[model samples]
Target: MMKVKEFMITDVVTVTKETSIKRLLEILVTNKIGGVPVVDAENKLQGMITDGDVIRYLQPKGRTVYDMFTLILVSEKEDLQHKLEYAIDHHVDKIMRKKEIFTVNPNDDLEAATSIFSKYRFKKIPVVDDSNKVSGVISRGDVIRYISTKLISDK
Candidate 1:
């Protein structure tokens, strides 16, 4: 049976809890990635952060002003804006997903990994070893490609 390691991306990009949100955004955009595993100095998976987190963190506080004359969404300053920006600049601890990080064992079957991704619709899953150290990242795109090439093509 093929395992996750057979199809996982070994060159995984990771971030630390102290990584600034601004710099995190740059890394995501530059790498064209949706999410990254959060790791400590010891390379242990601390948590995970996604683009959704970034968007949620960046959403303007309070309601938007609908201008009747110009018909536009007017921007207004709120107390949370500064706080969000500040949180992003200092570290990832403030915005990382501490509760719902989904990880898979390196020896796990690909089908099981696929099931997890399908159930959650997750963009990425951290592949970890027995010691809980991240060995690679398995993304939705990788799964799709693998299915198309290895399964569909065999049809």
Candidate 2:
């Protein structure tokens, strides 16, 4: 009956809602992490932001013009630089997943994390305390590592 706190990463990287998209990108690259939890000044959970969200937000829209004769006229694709110039200044809250963030408590069983990961395919889940303060983070890799080192080896 292992607990999430046993395998979760206590040294979690986090960001504030007002953090700029540029800074977020830097954090991701520097940390080599796919996602992070968004927290308030008190370290309370706010939302989650991931590399996928940033990519989707920064992707440039493409435009196509068609003539009445069903012929494609001008097809213009917005350049990456064009979109990044404007998006870099935006805050993470604009693109962060703010709704229905699934979380697990530090005292919860490891099975809780497995359930969420299997059901939602989440890369990470924030581990919170009784007051909703972020305590740690559990990733799919963390679960697998724990199983390899602890569970399977014991069997």
- TM-score of predicted structure 2: 0.88
Mark the regions of model 1 whose C-alpha exceeds 4 Å error after superposition.
Answer: 64-88
lDDT of 1: 0.84
Q: How many backbone clashes does candidate 2 have?
A: 0
Clashing pairs in 2: none
Q: Candidate 2: worst 10 consecutive residues by lDDT?
A: 71-80
Point out the worst 10-residue segment of candidate 1 by lDDT.
Answer: 70-79
Winning model by lDDT: 2
Each model's TM-score? 0.83, 0.88
Candidate that would win on TM-score: 2
Candidate 2: segments with Cα more than 4 A from true spot: 64-78
Clashing pairs in 1: 17-92, 21-88
Summarize candidate 2's per-residue lDDT along 1-155 as a digit string, tens digits. Answer: 88999989999999999999999999999999999999999999999999999989877666455688786633224456767888899999999999979999989999999999999999999999999999999999998887788777898
lDDT of each: 0.84, 0.92
